[model samples]
Target: MLGDIWNATLKGMNDLAGSVGEGAREKSLALIEDWLEIFPQLAEYGLEITSFSMGLAISPSLNVELLGKHEDWSDEAIAKRLADHKGEHSITTVLSTIRTAYRLQKKTQAPLRDPLILKIVVRISPEVRVVLGQPILDD
Candidate 1:
């Protein structure tokens, strides 16, 4: 039973990952960059940015509801550490933050429509810490 659950969970994660593809990733980044481009002077402020992988891993919708709180991290290094740790408290904290951001950005609308990626992001996100608002690279 335990093994079966694990397998199911992994499959779900894959499904979620597949939905938020390269196109969505690029589109999301472009949207954010356009939003931020207005403030060229604020470039030094290290706005924590998150990738599609991390966002999907932590399916922000469930996380926000679970934690009931959110806070931003200062840097990618700290975000990565929070994501890697397995402690319940740490996971909850990270998930809460991601969920809050997810809601704030209205990211759920699209992902929810795609069951596969939505499943992956929601199931795997508790273990991932995502920084928001990173600069998008020109492709």
Candidate 2:
């Protein structure tokens, strides 16, 4: 599963280079590589790191975006979407990149003031949420 994520993410990063400048492209790739290095810890929390990859171009650091897809906003939505959906436009590359922009805010740590990056706790699967001790609620 993680391998798929890594491959997909790597391809996504490579493809991203064409849409951005040379320096911005390299920064984006480095940031994704950094995130992938810590993927186990991030994955343990049950939230698939999402949209903030491009934010890395502007600032080499970022919290992931849980609202990478509108329906991915909550675990319930994630579960439902997983169970019944197929071929979502945003889900095409394991996540969406359109939501990312150079102007997006950034900080030293996660759970930023940005609404898109919020909801990660609830966005996680129920079991992982329990382990993480985050009381599940509507996202």
Prediction RMSDs, each to the true structure: 19.0, 18.4
lDDT of 2 by residue, 9-118 (tens): 99999878655666665665554554444344334434455544333334243434442223223545444543442554223222222123212322223333322332
lDDT of 1: 0.38
lDDT of 1 by residue, 71-98 (tens): 3233363456455644645334543555
Scored by CA lDDT, what does every candidate get? 0.38, 0.37
My TM-score estimates for the predictions, one after another, are 0.20, 0.23
Each model's number of backbone clashes?
Answer: 15, 0
Which whole-number lDDT from 0 to 100 does residue 9 have in model 1? 100
- In model 1, the Cα lDDT at residue 7 comes to 100
Model 2 residue 108 CA deviation (Å) reads 23
- CA deviation > 4 Å runs, candidate 1: 21-23, 29-139
Residue 75, candidate 2: Cα error in Å is 22
